[model samples]
Target chain A: MIGEYITSNTEIVESALTQSLPPAWQIPLPLRESMNYSLMAGGKRLRPILVLAAAESLGGTKEAALPVACAIEMVHTYSLIHDDLPAMDNDDYRRGKLTNHKVYGEAMAILAGDALLTHAFYSISQAHKVHGIPAERVLAITEELSAYAGARGMVGGQAADMLGEQGITKLEELEYIHSHKTSDLIVFSLRAGAHIAGASHAQLQALSQFGHAIGLAFQIQDDILDIIGDEAKLGKPVKSDEKQQKVTYPYFIGMEASEKKVRELTSQGKEALLQANLVHPERLLQLADYLMKRDH
Target chain B: MIGEYITSNTEIVESALTQSLPPAWQIPLPLRESMNYSLMAGGKRLRPILVLAAAESLGGTKEAALPVACAIEMVHTYSLIHDDLPAMDNDDYRRGKLTNHKVYGEAMAILAGDALLTHAFYSISQAHKVHGIPAERVLAITEELSAYAGARGMVGGQAADMLGEQGITKLEELEYIHSHKTSDLIVFSLRAGAHIAGASHAQLQALSQFGHAIGLAFQIQDDILDIIGDEAKLGKPVKSDEKQQKVTYPYFIGMEASEKKVRELTSQGKEALLQANLVHPERLLQLADYLMKRDH
Candidate 1:
C-alpha cells in the first residue's frame, strides 16, 4: 500500500525537500553545510508526502501544499537534530550516520537546529507568492504553523518528554507526550494542507480527526518496532527504550494489545476520510495501514 | 546618554517586555518559567529600549514598537541562555544569579532557549492584532529579525567567536566576531523600530549607519570593561575574557587604542543621527556616549 503511494509521489516529495533549502551562497558555508547534512540524510520523507497526499486527496494540486510540506519536514529535521544533542537523547548515530552534534559539535548542532526551525516559517510565508492564494489564507497558514511548532505544540511535547524521562510514568503522561511530540505536527501538516486547498470547514474537521488517529497509530507502531525491529534496518539501536526503562505503548500495554490498538486506530483514521467523502482516500488509508504495520 | 534613555524609557520598556509574554496558562508552565527567569533577570534592557526609542524618535507611539522591542529582547535572552551552557561559555552565573541551566538543568535550558527564539517571531506576528500594523510590515520585520538572529548574523558571530578561541587571532577576525556577535542584533533592533514606524527609506538607511557605529562602539567598550571595570559593577567576572584567552578587541588593538576607537565610533554614530535631522536625537546620542564610556 505504502509502496504504491511512494511510487506515485516519491519524486515530488524528494524534489520538494531537496530544493526547499536556499542556495549555498546565500547562507554561510558552515551553517549551510550543517543544515544540509541532516536535511539530506536519508529518511522516508513521510510528513511531507502525507501533506501532498492529503491535499491531492482533497482535490487540491500538489503546488498548493508544497511549501507547507517542506516546512513540516524542516521542523521534523530540526527536532531530530536537537533531540540527538548531548543534553537530550544523546544519540551518536541517526539513519546509520553520525548525528548532527557528533558531526558538527554541540554548539553548531544547536544553532543549525535553531536556524532550520526559524527558516521553516520563512518558507511558509514565501508560499504567498503562489499566484491565486488569498493573503488571509497565507497569514492563517503561517499562524497555524507557528502555533504547532511553538510552545503550545512541539516544544510543549519536548518539555513533557524531558520531564517524563526523569519522573514517574503514567498512561496519561505517555499519551500527553505522544500527542504533543509526535501527533501535533502531523495534525498541523494535514490542517495546513486543508487550509491551503480551501477545504470546507466540515472537511477540515474530518481531516484533523484523521490526522490525530493516524498520528497516534504511527507512534504506537514505533513503540512496537523498537521492541522487535532489527538495529541495522532501523538505522539506530533497537530496544534502547527497554534498556533505558522508558515508558512506551508496547511497554505499558503489552505488544499484542498495542498491535490491536494500532489496527483499531488505523481503521478509525480511514473512517474519518469516508465521513468527509474525500475524493481519493486510498493513499491516506494506505498510509495509515502502512504506519500501523511497518516493522521499522 | 544610554543611562538617560534607559531611565526615561525604563517603565514602558519593562512593562512591554513583561506583558509581551503570553500568560503562564497559554504557554506550558515550565517553558513560561524558563522564559520569565531569563527575561526578568535584571540587566540593562538596552536592545528593547533602543527599539522603542528609535520608534518614538521617529514620531511613532511606543505601542508601535513594543512587540519588536520585546522580540529583540527575547532573541537576546535566548542567546545568553545558550551561551552560558556548559558546551559554550560554561558560566554558572549571569546577572548575579544562577544562569538558566544552573537553575533549570541543561535540557530545560536548551528547550527554554529554543522556545524563546521561536516565540519571538510569534510575538512579532501578534503585533498586528495589538498595534494595528499591516501584516506585510510585520512580515518584513520578522524577516529582518530572523536574518539578524540566524546563521548569517548573531549565530554566525557566535560561531566565529568559538572558532577564534581555538585558532589564530587577527584584528579583522576580532572585528568580524564582535560585529556579528554584538552589533548585528543592535542594528536589527534599531532597524526594526524604523520598520515598525514606517520610516522613510533614507531615514532607515541613516538608522542603519547609526546602529552599526554604536554596535561596534558598544563591543569595544565591553572589551575595555573586561580589563578595567569592577566585577561587582559588571555583575559577571572581570578579565574573564583575557583569562580564557578569547580573542577580544582590547587584546587585538591595545586597550588605549580600543578606547580611542570607541570614542571615534561614538562620534560617528552621533553624526549619522545628526545628518538625519532626527528629533530628540539626544536619546540615541546619549546612548552612543554611554555605550562608549560605560564603566560596566
Candidate 2:
C-alpha cells in the first residue's frame, strides 16, 4: 500500500514538473532544452514526495502543494548539475547517463543550473497566484527555502565537504557536513509542505525533528549502499566511494554500525511524526520504513 | 547634487550589504569570504541605487527599501561572479580587483555565486519580516523578481548572448539580447521599488518605460565607452570589445548613430518619468542623464 502511494504521488509530481516550464519556443531554445534535459531525467522524486506526503499528512490538497514540490525538485536537480561540473566532482555520469555538463558543455550547464535555481522561487509564488494559497504562507515558505538552501545551510555544508576533502579525522565534522549538505533541504521540503497546509508551530517543529532524523539516516544509507549494493539497481558502480577514498559512515564506524544507525534514526523519525497529531500520517510513517530498508 | 545623492545612497547600500550576510563565524569561512570578496569589490551600485531611487520617488522609506535594494545587488553580483568563471567569460579581474574565481578556486567561486543568488530572496523576505512591508506586496515583488531574473529574463538574455557569440550579424537579434539581458533587471528594479511603495498601475507602467529606454541606452553607452573612454577610469581595458571581436552597438550602427541613440533614449526615459506624477522625479531624471553621459 505504501509503495502504491509513493508511485502515485511520484506520477503526480512528474506531470506537474513537465507542465511547470513555459513551452520551448517561449524561452530561448537552448536554455529551455538544457533545463528540461536535467529536470526530466528521472530520479526517486524523494524530495517532492516528502513535500506531498507532509502536506497530505497535514490535510492539504496536492494541487496546492504541487508547485512547491516541483520547485524543490528543481533545486535538487540544479545542485546535482553543479556538483557534477569538472571543477567540482568531475563526474561524467549520474544515474547511468551523461551528467548535465557532459551533454550541455560547462557554460550552458552553469547557466541552466542558475536558471533552474531562480525559477524555483517563481514556482513557489505560483502556489499563491494560481492555486489560491495565502500570500503569508507562501512568503513563509520562501523565507525558509532561502535559509535552508543558502550559505549557512546546504552551501555551507558543501563548502565544508570540499574543505574537508583534504583529510577528515573527526566525526563531528563529518556529522556537520551530512546534516547541512544532506539534511537542510530535506528539512526545508517538510517545512515548506507544512507551511502550505497551515501547520501550527508545534507541527512544524515536529516535522523538523523528523526531517533531521530521516535525512541523516537517508545519507547514511547511501553510504552503506555504496559499500555493498547491486550496481544495476543503484544505477552506478558500487564502492565508488572507496575508489574516491572519501570518508563515509562505514569508514568512520563500521558497516554494521551504519546499518544499525539507519534503523534507529528511521524509527526515531517516525516516532517524532507520530506525536505531531497530524490528520493522516500513515503514508509518511510507511515511507520512513521503506526508506530505511530500500536497497537503492 | 545628483553626485551627492548617489554617493550617500551608495554608502547606505554598502553598509547594509555588509550587514546582510551572517558573520564570518556563522557561515563557512571560505564561502563567506568568497561571497564578500566580490560583493564588496564595488561597482557603481547602479541597480541597487535604481531600486532606492524609484522607491523614494514614490514616497517609500529608505529603511523599507534598503533590504530589497541590497537583495538586487546580491543578484547582480552573483551574475558577475558566475559570468567571470573560466568556463564562462574567463575574466580574471573585476572592479580593479581579482575576480572571485581568481582568489578562490573555481569551485568555491561557483558555490559563492550560488549562495548569493539564493540569499537574494532571503533578503527580499527580510523586507517584510524585518522592515514591515506588506506580505502581499512582498509576495508580488518575489514573483516579479523570479520572472525578471530567471530563464525568461536575465538568464535568457545571457544564453542568447553566448549563442550569439558565434556571430551576431542581425540587429534584431542583438536587440533581443540587449533588451532581455540588460533591460529586464532594470525594469524589474523599477517595478519592485514601485511595488514596495504601493505605487499605482500607471506609475508602474511609467517606470517600465523609463526602465527600458534607459536600460538599452545604458548598454549602448557601455559600448561607446569601450571605444572612447579612459582605461583607468573604466577599471578595464578599452577597445576590449573589438579585441574580442564581440558585436556592439557601434559595430553595426556606427559611433555617431550609437551616441545619438543613447541621448534620445535618455531623454525619453526622463520624459516618461516626468509624466508619472511622482513625489520626487528630479533625482531619477538626473540619474538617467548621468548614466547616459558616464565615461565608465
Candidate 3:
C-alpha cells in the first residue's frame, strides 16, 4: 500500500523536480550536465514525495509544495554527493552508479555539491513566487528548512557522527548523532509540508511529533538493513556501515531490541498522525509501517 | 580611502557577526565551538561590510541590512573553509591560524562548512521576518544570492579555476576564472545591498556593472599582492600562489600589464558608480581605488 503511494507521489515529484530545474543556457555545459547527473540519478524521491503526501493529507494542493519538495530533494542530493567525497564517506557508488566525485573528479564534485545546495534555496525562494501562495508563508517554510538543515540540525548531527566514529560508545551519544544526522531533515520534510499547507498550531505540533517518531524509526531500519540486507537490494554495498565502524541502534541495543524499537516508534508515529485528525492519515500510517518493514 | 571605508565597515560587520552567532544550548558544545572558530576567524569582512555600506548609502537602515550582511559573510566563510579542505586547496593555515580541517579534522571541517552555508540563508530568512521586509523582495534577494554563489557563479568560477590550473596559458581563460569567482560574490554583495534598500532597477544595473569591474579589480589586486605584498602586511604568507603554481593574473599578464589592468578596472568601476547618483559615492569610489592601490 505504501509502495503504491510512494510510486504515485514519486512520479509527481520527478515531474516537479524536472520543471524546477529548467536548464540554464548561461551555465557552462559541463556544469549543467553535472547538475542534471546528480538530480536525475534515480532514487526513491522519498523526501519530496513525503512532502507532497503530507501536504495533500493536510488539504493543500500538491502543486503548492512542488518547489519545496524539489528543494528538499536537492539538499538531500547535495548531502549525498558531499558525503561520498574522498574526504567524507569516500563511497565509489551511489544509487547503483558512480558517485559525483567518481565521475567528475574531486574538484568538480565539490563544486557540484556546492551548486546543488545553493540551488536548493533558489528553488525554495522561487516557490514563493509561484502564483498562489502567500509570500510570507513561503518565506516561513524556507526558513524552517534552512534551520533544520543547518548548524543546529543536520550539519550538527553529521559533526557528532564524525566524532562518534572515533569511539562514542554511549547509547545517548549515538542517538544524538542519529537525531541530527538522519532525523533532522526527515522532521523538516514533514514540517515544511505542513507549514505550506497552513497547518494549525495544534496540527503542526502533532505532525512534529509524528515526524520525530518516524524519523528515528527510519534510521533504525537503515541500521538494520545495513546489517541484514544484500548490496544489490540496498543499491550499495552491504555492511558498509560496519566497514566504517560507525555506531548504530543495533550496535547499542541487540538486533532484537532494535527491531522492537522500530515497531514501538512506528506505533507512536501512527498515533500522532491519528491524534492530528488528518484528512488522509492512512498513507502516512502505512508509510511508517512500510519504513520499518522494507528490505532496503 | 577605500581601505578606510572597508576597515570601518569591517568593525561594524565583525560585531554584528558576533551577535548573530550566539551560542545555542541545543547544539553540542564542540560543534558550536567549531562553528565559532571558523566564523570568528579574522578576515577583511569586505563582503558583509559592502552589504551594509551599500544599503546605508542608499538610505536603508543599518539594522535592516545587518542580517543580510552577516549572511553574506557566512556564505563567504563557508566557501573559504571548504576551499581549504584537503580535497580542495588543502591549506593548513588561514588568517594566520590553523585552517578548519587542520584544527577540527576533515569531517568536522566539512560539516562546519556545510552548516555555515546552510545557516546563512536561514539567517537571511529570519532577518526578513524580524525586519518585516516585503516577502517578494526577500525572495528576490535570496534568488540572487543563490545564483551568484551557485554553479553559474562562484562555484562555476572555482571549477574553472581548478581546471585552468591544469594548463591555461590564455589570458582570457584566466580572466574568465577570476571574473566569475571573486567578482561574482562582490557583484552579489553590491546587488544584495541595493536589493534590501529597494534601489531602482537602473541603479541595480549600474551597481552590478560597478561590482563586476571592482570585483575583477579586487582579484587582480589579490593576485598582485600574492607576488609583491609583504608577508607581515598581508597577514598571511605571500608568494604561496607561485608555490602552488596556481594560474593567476600576474602569471598570465606579467606584473606591468597586470598593474595597468588593475588601474583600468578601477577606473571603470568608479565610472559605473558615477552613474548612480548615490548619496555618498566616495565610499564606493574609494573602495575601488583601495582595491587597485592597496599593497595588501
Candidate 4:
C-alpha cells in the first residue's frame, strides 16, 4: 500500500510538472530541451512527494499542494543542473544520461538552470492567479522560498560545500554544508505543504524539525549508498565521494557511525511528526523509511 | 535638475543595494565577492532609476519603490554576468573592468550570478514584509515580474537573440530579441511601480504602452551607440555587435533610419505617458530623454 501510495504520487507529480512548465515549444528549442533533459529524466521525485505527503497528513488536498510541490521540484532540478556543471561537480552523467552541459553546452546549461529557478516562482504565481490560492499566502510562501533557496540558504550551503573540501574537513563545516545545502530546501518543502494547509504555528514548527532531521538522514544515506549501492541502480559511479578525496559522513565518522546516525535521525523525524497530531502520518513515515534505505 | 535628480537617486539606490545583500564576509567569501564585483561596479543604474522614476511619476513614494528598484538591478546584474560567459558573449570586461568570471573564475561567477538572481525575489519579499505594501498588490507585482523575467520574457528573449544571430536577420526576429532581452525588464520596472501605486486599468495599460515604446527605443539607441559612442564612456569595446555579425538596428536598418525609429518610439512613449494623465511626468520624461540622447 505504501509503495502504491508513493508510486501513484510520483506519477501525479510528474504529470503536474509536465503541465506546469511553459510548453517546451513555447521557448527557444535549445533552452527548453536542456531544461526538459534534466527535469524529465527519472529521479525519486522525493521533494514534491514530501510536499504532498506533508500536506495530506496535515489535512490539505493534493490539489492545493500540487503547485508548491512542482515549484520545489523545479528548484531541485535547477540545483542539480548547476551542481553538475564543469566548474562544480564536473560530472558527465546524471541518472545515466549525458549531463545538461554535455548536450546543450555550458552556456545553455547555465541559462536553462536560470530559467528553471525563475520559473519556480512563475509556477506558484500561476497557481495563485488561476487556482485561486489566496494571493497573500502565495506572497508569504514566495518570501519563505527565496530565503530558503537564496544566498543565505541553498546557495550559501553550496558555497560552503565548495570551500569545505579544500582541506581536512571539520565536522562543523560539514554539518553546515549538509544542513544548508541539503536540509534547508528539504525543510522548506515540508513547510511549503504545511503553509498551504494552513497549519498552526506549533504544527509548522514541528514539521520543520521533522524535515530537518529527515534531510540530514537523507544525505547521510546518500553517503552510505555511494559505497554500497549498485552503480547501475544508482545510475552513477559508486565511491565518488572517496574518489574525490572529499569528506562524507562515512569518511568522517566511519560507516557504522554513519548508519547509526541515519537511524537515530529517522526515528527522531518520525517521532516529531507523531507529536504534531497529524491525521495521517503513516505515508510520510513510510516514505522516510523508504528514502533512508533506498539504493539510489 | 535632471542630472541632480539622477545623481541623488543613484546614491540612494546604491546605499540600499549595499545594505540589502549578504555582508561580504558572510558564509562564503568568494561567492559574495564575485556577486559584489559586478553589482557594485559602476554603471548608469538606469533600471533602478527608472523604477524609482516610474513610482514617482505614478504618485508613489521613492521609498516605497526602493527595494523593488534594487531587486531590478540585481536581476540586471545577473543577466550581465551570464551574458559575459565564454560560451555566451565571451566578453572579458564590463563597465571598464574585468568581468566577474575573469576575476573570480567561471564557477564562482556563475554561482554569484545565481545567488543574485535568487536574491532579487528575496529583496522584494523584505520590502513586502517591512514596506507596508499591501500583500495582494505585492502578489500581483510578483506575478507580473515572473511573467516578464521568466522563460517567456527575458530568458526567452536572450534565447531568441542567441538563435537570431545564427542565420539571416529579419526585422521581426530582431524586434523580438530587443523587446524581450532589453525592454521586458524595463517595462516591468515601470509596471511594478504602477501596481504598487494602484494605477487604474486604463492608466496601467497606457504605461505599458509607454514602457514598450521606450524599451524598443532604448535597444535601438544601444545599437546606434555601439557604432558611434565613445568606447571609454561606454566601458566595453564598441562594435562588438558588428564583430559578431549579429543583427542590430543600425546594421539592419542603417544608422539614419535607426535614429529615426528611436525618435518615433520616444515620441510615442511620451505621448502614451501624456495620455495616462500622470501627475508628475517631468522626471520620467527627463529620464527617457537622457537615455535616448545618452552618449554612453
Whole-model lDDT values for every prediction: 0.81, 0.92, 0.82, 0.86
Q: Give one digit per residue, the lDDT tens place, for model 3 in B150-175.
A: 88788888777777677888888888
- What digit string (tens of lDDT, one per residue) describes model 2 on residues A1-296? 88898899999999999999866775889889899999999999999999998999999998999999999999999999999999998898889989998888999999999999999999999999999999999999998999898898888898899888879898889899999998999999999999999999999999999999999999999999888898998888888877877899889899899989999999999899988999998888888888899989
| TM-score for chain A as predicted in candidate 3 | 0.96
* Docking quality (DockQ) of candidate 1: 0.46
Candidate 4 overall Cα lDDT vs. reference? 0.86
Assign candidate 1 its CAPRI class: acceptable
Off by over 4 Å in 2: none
lDDT digits (tens) for residues A58-156 of candidate 1: 788888788878888888999899888989888899989999988888988887888788777767776666534555566666667767777777888
Q: Model 3 misses residue B294 by how many Å?
A: 1.3
Q: List, for all models, the DockQ compared with the true complex.
A: 0.46, 0.88, 0.67, 0.73
Instruction: Between candidates 3 and 4, name the one with more favorable DockQ.
Output: 4
* Worst 10-residue lDDT window, candidate 2 chain A: A21-30
Please report how far candidate 1 places residue A93 from its true position, in Å.
1.5
**Highest lDDT model number:** 2
* Candidate 1: regions farther than 4 A off: A1-4, A7-10, A22-28, A57-61, A129-135, A198-204, A273-282, B1-5, B25-28, B274-282
Q: Give the DockQ ranking, best first.
A: 2, 4, 3, 1
Clashing pairs in 2: none
Is model 4 an incorrect, acceptable, medium or high docking prediction?
medium
